[model samples]
Target chain A: MRARVLVRPKAGILDPQGQAVERALPALGFDGVRNVHVGRLIELDVEDASQLPEMCEKLLANPLIEDYEIVQ
Target chain B: MRFPGSCDDVDALLAAEMVGEAEILWHGEHNLRGVDAIVVPGGFSYGDYLRPGAIARFSPVMESVMAFAREGGPVLGICNGFQILCEAGMLPGALLTNVSLQFVCRQVTVEATGASSAFTGGFAAGARLSIPVKHTTGRFYAPAAELDRLEQAGQVVLRYAPGENPNGSLRDIAGVCNETGTVMGLMPHPEHAVDPLTGSTDGLKLFQALRDHVGSLLAA
Candidate 1:
């Protein structure tokens, strides 16, 4: 099975990368960028989708710094 | 010197003590194959220029670090290392400039948050420790709901004492573990205060815990 894990910093967490992208958007002539929080996208090929939750807990995301979802 | 001089300082300390005694690999040449555990030592790689770990995330070493973590290898990122881990998406959450907007350097009291990870297994639940935190960007922030989930899951590894809240982190959290408790990141320099002559030896337990955990895994 193929799984895509979308990981993002939790709410209220300050995302420096997101902030930087937000700042750059104005220069790119793309305004209305209220807030941008950067995150990670991890693609994996697993033997079984049932292992996704365990994968998320073990490697896909650090629960302390990120939240993640697995799309199978 | 991409980051700050502190990274160099921590590197020197680790080298002097042979913290791991493992072979060191240059940036891209190693792919973390057959590696047991990875240590993101403290250093201002890339000079801490963009953000503490912003630039280093693109470094060659990070490719190996990420791969290692993905394969379930134990990874520990200290101080600036913690910053890099977050940037590399190895850990969650972002560490921002201190809430006070000042670099804090001092010994602070920490309480174990009942985590049972390779890093904290040696300590009893609710163990109190004094470790030195030195950084301007050590404040930890996460959404309130996520913080609640972490607390409920017992993933919080260390929290600052009530009166000794050093960086204004949410719930005074000082360190945390991944859900499985294998990966960990913290702002304090446990490598710095590990020896008895260093004034506080509480940090030794962290390294020892890693060694023990890895040893047990290999034995198993």
Candidate 2:
């Protein structure tokens, strides 16, 4: 089975990279974006799908700093 | 000790040797070789492929380092080592990208919060040291509750002086130690400040404190 883990800075955590992109978009004629947050996507193949969250808890995501949701 | 991509290992080793015998422990090894103290230096370990210090935190050697620190051994992590320690769950809080979103490199003043940690044992409370910091993801982040707890417990060992916060760490925190005060991590490169030729010897005080901590442990 393959799973995707989306890792993001926890809510209220500052996201400078996302803010930089959001600022640039307005300068290039895009607008109306608010509260932009950047994150990473990790796709992996594993033998047991049930262990995806455990994998994220152990390695794929840092619970202290990031939140992860697994998609199958 | 040196990880594969650790560029500051030599400087750390040299600084440690000035106080006592020093060595290079491989990141792939599980043995600490009976060292009294450990220094995880700075660099783009694993090429910083993911978040800084994310991958290197799981190195085989870190298991032993964790065990050593848990047993009250003195361990200091500088820059990337600091990031690795935080990612490894050995320290509270996380380092985020700088608020300015730029790689900052400069000499800054950091004050010792207290003589509570093994690394800060040589300095009196409020003793200020000049050290150079160079990094992008150096802003320390912790939830409000955790931040209050760390402050109350004296786990915050060093803080940037007023107006000297290069990376905008929370409350200007520059270094933090575990509850036992045996393990510590900081963003500034103390190894780079040990020599007068480098324009500051304030860093030597930290190394000396490590040596004294080890000596006291051996004597006990």
Candidate 3:
């Protein structure tokens, strides 16, 4: 079995990298990019698909600063 | 010291151990008996891969460190050590990359957070100390409510002085202690500031505070 996790900085938390990209978009001849947020994707191969949440909680994502969505 | 890679100041620490200023023990969990305290020094542990301090949190030695913290033993984490503590869930908040996304290395002034803890006992309220910090990912972050709780509980023990927030830490926080006040994690390197040759001796008070705390325990 395989699982994929999408991790993102929580809302209201500062995302400097995302903000930098958003700021540069207008200068590069692009516009209307609002609320830009940066995140990461992690892929894993596992024996049991049900254990992904626990894995996400334990190591893949830090609950204090990030949120993770697990996909099968 | 048992980690696959050691800090740049390993020789300096060994020098401290040699002079009997500090009785450094290099043992893992099984031999942790009678260990008075644990100092997780600064360094690029685990190559800073997958973000700073993330992979090192799973190291075998941390299990012992966690047990020590649970028992109210004094544990000080500096720089990379601080990152490990946050990753291991031993401390609140997380360290993100600097707002400028550049590595910061220099001497900065930190103010005492008025929180009473074994680590900050040597300083007076509102006292400021000079400490050196070297890190790429040293910005601290926590939710607003949790930040309020930390303040209410006096867990915040240190903060960068105004105009010296080197890494965009929330509330200018430079260091924090756990609820019980035994475990502390900070980005500044006190060990590096112990001698005048390094510029200032302001960081010595931190070690003195730890010594006093441990001494009192032994006297009791």
Top candidate by TM-score: 2
Which has the greatest lDDT?
Answer: 2
The clash count of every prediction, one per candidate, is 12, 0, 0
In model 1, what lDDT does residue B21 have? 51
How far out, in Å, is residue B156 in model 1?
1.1
Write candidate 1's Cα lDDT for B124-218 as tens digits: 77798888888888888777887898889877899887888877788898888887788898988777776677788778778778878888888
Q: Candidate 2: where is the Cα deviation over 4 Å? A: none
Give the clashing pairs for model 3.
none
| Candidate with more favorable, higher TM-score: 1 or 2 | 2
Displacement of the residue A72 alpha carbon in candidate 2, Å: 1.2
RMSD of each: 9.1, 1.0, 2.2
lDDT by residue for model 2 (B1-220), tens: 7887899999999999888899999999999999999999999899987788889988999999999988888889999999999999999999999999999999999999874889888678889999999999899989999999999999999999999999879899999999989999999999999999999988989999889888999999
TM-score of 2: 0.97
**B165: Cα error in model 3, Å:** 0.5
Residues A1-72, candidate 1: write the lDDT tens digits.
Answer: 778999887776666667778888999899898879877788889888898888776556656667888887
lDDT of 3 by residue, B1-220 (tens): 3444448446336433432355444424335656677777778877877667788788877887888789888988888889988998899999997888788999999999778887898567689999898888899898889899999999999999999999899999999989989999999988887777889877778877877888888899
